[model samples]
Target chain A: MRSKRALRYGLLGLSAALIGVGLLRQEHLEVLGKAVRICLECVGIG
Target chain B: MSGMRRNRIKWPLSRQRTIQLISAALVNGYIAGFQKGRIFTGGTKAVCVPVLNCYSCPGALGACPIGALQTAVGGVKHHFPFYVLGLLMLFGVLLGRAVCGLLCPFGLVQDLLHKIPSPKVRVPKGLDRPARGIKYVVLLVFVILLPAFAVTETRVTPPYFCQYICPAGTLGGGIPLMLADPALRQLAGWLFNWKVLVLVVIAAASVLIHRPFCRYLCPLGAFYALFNRFSFFQMSLDAHKCVGCGACERVCPMAVEVTKDINSPECIRCGACQTACPTGAIAGPLKKQSPR
Candidate 1:
């Protein structure tokens, strides 16, 4: 039970840290730029 | 064979089903864009949702984690997808495939279609076990490998999964855009036709099989399955309450052996097993505990 909880919260912490790294790097802006455009490929045009 | 799978319940709108509908609505909340034939271009669009909703869907308020991952992987400017991967990891750590069972719009579509009352088909375990691995293959080959390594003639990396395979793209993104704009219809070609064919097959298959796409093709579900075993909200089976009645296994949509492995990756956390367990052996945080 202890190990399980540790693994669960450990991964959660790692996820939060990665998100911080991503934001500091402005990777969300890249997602924003792609998402704002009507991705024709996603519309099955490609 | 699936006579008492889930349709017969204490209430018409079960808690999971209600959450599914509400999540779908909230994920695709920009309803005006659906009529206007335009995608939402707001700050919220940067945020990634945990489901397989297509970003091209006119009403989508946020990007799909899978789609955003592929886009970032395929981007020339953005070499790595820290944001999308982080978001996906966060969702998986939190809920695992409960996101599929309780939140995915495409999962809701499959569940509704599977309710159409037909002779259900269950694939033999010999084939089904092998078939389940296809989604992981899709995640590796289409979502990751092709985007990161396979360069097109123009030196641009295409999101191969969305362009060539995603049926959600056809139903939620392609069809609506085609209906809304003449130019998009004119633009539709062999790829669009292929997508429609894929959608039709999945739709027909859904009537006879529960979540064939999620079980066999959804890369998003595959990604979440990795975290299912240790995810925070996984169901716990009470050995003391279990009478080995085998009720839970029979109703499992994913064919999981509920008594043996209630927290299996294939178990969508849809509560069918919990509902079917006569002794209430299979209870989760979502379920009420019986007094000892």
Candidate 2:
């Protein structure tokens, strides 16, 4: 039972880590670039 | 299927529902990404994820309530943000902090943290209740006063609650965004370091202490609490049916006094108390207060 719970959590953590990576990977670069541009603009520069 | 297997299947479905809500938050942040307008246009503008998520967080969909409140208060206009406040009140009256228990991405992080196979701490009633008031003070000073009078002109600012306090911002929006972008990495100055440190402390604390942020510094929780008494969705305890056995209280994750005030602000409406009651004294919207 305890090992089952561990496996469940392990899967969940793995998925979140994957999503986090996916969010940063090649597909999400446009959003990342835009967000960076906005943050820089907020601080008064390019 | 056997009873145990049925229960096991149900648990994963429930967790999936929670994941769906986190996706909804992310989608909302994506939609609201275009706007970061000035103070007169209701200064703070990030959509609040129930558990006091930060407005400046990278993936945040809408204006954070606490940040909005602080910016509105601190803005030269110095009037309450009627639109934001009204929207928050409506949500509170409808759902209470069920948003925290089920929907918040940050709350999801804490739930994940609690699963880390560590010693968990249950705060004693003597200490927990008083400590819960800290968010109110944060709302008063950081969200309200500091932004209202702190500056001479209406300089738009992220509320201090978000800048210094929110772990949700740290986890959901901050770390993820920084991890994705290298330029954001270069800009990681003293303030960013401070934010990360605060996030680390909160993340570590969440492992031992169940939702220390929700208990202590979530201004959104504080706001929802104001409407808990009058919220359309509420928990009711029948005095005649309840034997005053401490079962409901013991089951409550948020440590609400279920018998005395089932609708207390601290009650996240997790439905644990309803399930815990052997006599079935506690009832929800579908059930009667007295069980007829």
**Number of the top-ranking candidate, with DockQ as the measure:** 1
* Cand. 2 TM to true fold: 0.71
Tens digits of per-residue lDDT, candidate 1, B148-186, equal: 888767666889999888999889989998999999999
True lDDT of residue B80, candidate 2: 46
Report the error of model 1 at residue B62, Å.
Answer: 0.4
lDDT of each: 0.88, 0.59
Clashing pairs in 1: none
lDDT of candidate 2 over B1-292, digit per residue (tens): 0111111123544543455465546634443333322111121233333445544455455555555555455544555455445446556656677766666666666656655656667887788889999988877777777766667543654456656666665655556556665676677676667777877888898777767877888777787777666565677787878888899887676878788777788877667687778888887754444454
Superposed by TM-score, candidate 1 places the C-alpha of residue B53 at a distance from the truth, in angstroms, of 0.5
| Least accurate 10 contiguous residues by lDDT in model 2 chain B | B1-10
For candidate 2, the per-residue lDDT at B113 reads 67
